[model samples]
Target: MSSPWFGSQRSQSMTEFALVAPILLLMLFGIIDFGRLLYIYGTLVEAANEGARVSIKASSPLPSNSDVENAAKNGAQSLYLANPCPNGPLPPTSGAGAQNPPGDQGWIFITEPNPPTTVETSPTYDAPGGQSPASATGSCSAINPFQSGTYPLQVTVRYNYLFFTPLLEQLAPSIILQAYATDYTEY
Candidate 1:
């Protein structure tokens, strides 16, 4: 024979679980959304790097704009889903917005003359504790002229990531994930 307190223990446990379930579910959704965000960001970064790599290859003829764009598309082929965010904002073409210009893949931007200054970049071009790489006087010369030394090439990929959770959408909407890769020609 159990006391009244023990008799109601199962109900108490049920009540506690009912109170905590929503919060726990919310946390679980948040973790999943965070993981998705990271995956998208990593994909964008690799796509941009692939575009830059295509542009800077030591091959005789330089890669055309379309070629680089194709490389980027191939790099991010996993994200070729049917509109991840149909209701969300579209990527901006210029200005303080997304800065994603029109490309074969729609979100890749290429700059062959100088590295982009809009986003934070790692100092991969410079030696440890050494001076940053500077643009030379004839850096932007035509390929026919074939200027000496290394020339900078930058590729950028912008993606509008929509949260899978409805709570996240109400709180912050979509996040614009931008990635940039800069490389120099092997001369």
Candidate 2:
């Protein structure tokens, strides 16, 4: 009896552990990766919301494209406890003066005047070949669109999130998040 108990049982248990160890490790890694992904998503949402809130401020004239970029960077840093923008800075604001147009930029939006419409033509810029000529440009209106209570403030944020875990990186190299909000400014 003693010989029977010792001969095969110990080896069987060892074999079971050997068979299960890798699976267990992979499961643990999966859980960790999922949690990290969730955290990143939450952080991105908060950052976008923060950016939108900052954009609706009429009193301060809303942040410039650079300012919005900084706001996003700060928001992400605060939420993630790490800097998300390592390539010098987050994308410049989307409005004029930005290195890249807002639509093309990675993050940030400003309430600059929409491009002007020509009296000679219907609002056609939305269609192909509708872009105004370079000489057709005019200074942005001094009038705040929100003054008449018709145009509400708009906030938009774009974020590029990088995974902190190697496992997640291998699965989904990176993630992009976008958020938008609309609210009237008191000013």
Candidate 3:
């Protein structure tokens, strides 16, 4: 005399769980990945700013491309600059402290824009433009920074980030993060 609904509740509940579990897991992972992305981006931007700040100084010993590059890399090194892919070593940092990358350094670049030309050469003597010498390119270098006049110094950084969530892999291999900063030289 048992009804057809003797134990249907248990089976129905299991089916519902099976369907909802994946969705919930995906949502959790997405949130984690997005937060990681923002943190990494902020770090990169700060690094670039630090590099530009150092390069804009017009001192006896000017900064070089490598010097700027080092600054940028060092600033962001405390974080996972590259993909920590599964099985990777310990994270760049465990807590809220800074540490160097467990693996190789991420790709960093610093460019030097051509400074303004004070002298003009042509069939006749003429000024290139009314722009002052300080009107140099925004790029900066330890070798030569903006001198004597107020000019803009720019720093750029790029990073390849790996997602810990496998779901990201299906969408794309790796995400690209970039940072740039521009500061005026001390006149």
Candidate 4:
């Protein structure tokens, strides 16, 4: 004769597994999504740092806006695979220049915190927290050099991060991650 417990054990185990499976899967996917978010954010920060480093070097000819931008792009090639989303966040303040890059790839903004002694020729990309200079257009551009004083060179990188998990999408349909690197310009 089959024991009562033995006869029902298989069904009970299956029921328990069925009840716990969704939660476990959800947790597992949640972890994966979180990891991806961290990785992308870290990459963005590293890219900004790299661009700032390139900008700070005392080269015979200062690195052009493109050069610094290239360094940043190279630093985070993995981001290209990510599905591009619309630009995230407006410039710091309403008046501040729009920080979002024109292209889906992203953009690098090189700005001097302290106004340069000479008038900037490249068309100011950002106002003192206002819309990008009317003269400046495109994703990246080199700001004019400062005559004196150790002013900080700020490199800001913006990228829209797309979440893989549906739940994350519900919570955050569009997420833009920004990273900044500041280094004193080499005189």
Give the best candidate by TM-score: 4
List clash counts for every candidate, in order.
0, 2, 4, 8
Report the lDDT of model 1 for residue 84.
22
Q: Rank the candidates by TM-score, best first.
A: 4, 1, 3, 2
Instruction: Write one digit per residue (lDDT tens) for candidate 4, span 1-187.
Output: 6686576677889999999999998888889988987888899899878977877776656565566667778888766522121011124411345333332345556665432322333633221121123332233232344533455766677776666778867887656677878887664
- TM-score against truth, every candidate: 0.66, 0.53, 0.61, 0.70
What lDDT would each prediction earn against the true structure? Answer: 0.58, 0.44, 0.53, 0.58
**Residue 36, model 3, lDDT:** 82
Q: Where in model 4 is the C-alpha error above 4 Å?
A: 1-7, 81-105, 114-134, 137-143, 147-149
**Residue range with the least summed lDDT across 10 consecutive positions in model 3:** 122-131
Relative to the unseen true structure, what is the Cα RMSD of model 4? 6.9
Flag the better candidate by TM-score, 1 or 2: 1
Candidate 1: segments with Cα more than 4 A from true spot: 3-7, 81-106, 112-149
The residue ranges of model 2 lying beyond 4 angstroms of the native Cα positions read 4-8, 60-62, 78-150, 160-171
In model 4, residue pairs whose N, Cα or C atoms come closer than 3 Å (at least 3 residues apart or on different chains), thus clashing, are 95-130, 95-131, 96-129, 96-130, 96-131, 97-130, 97-131, 97-132
The lDDT, on a scale of 0 to 1, for candidate 1 is 0.58
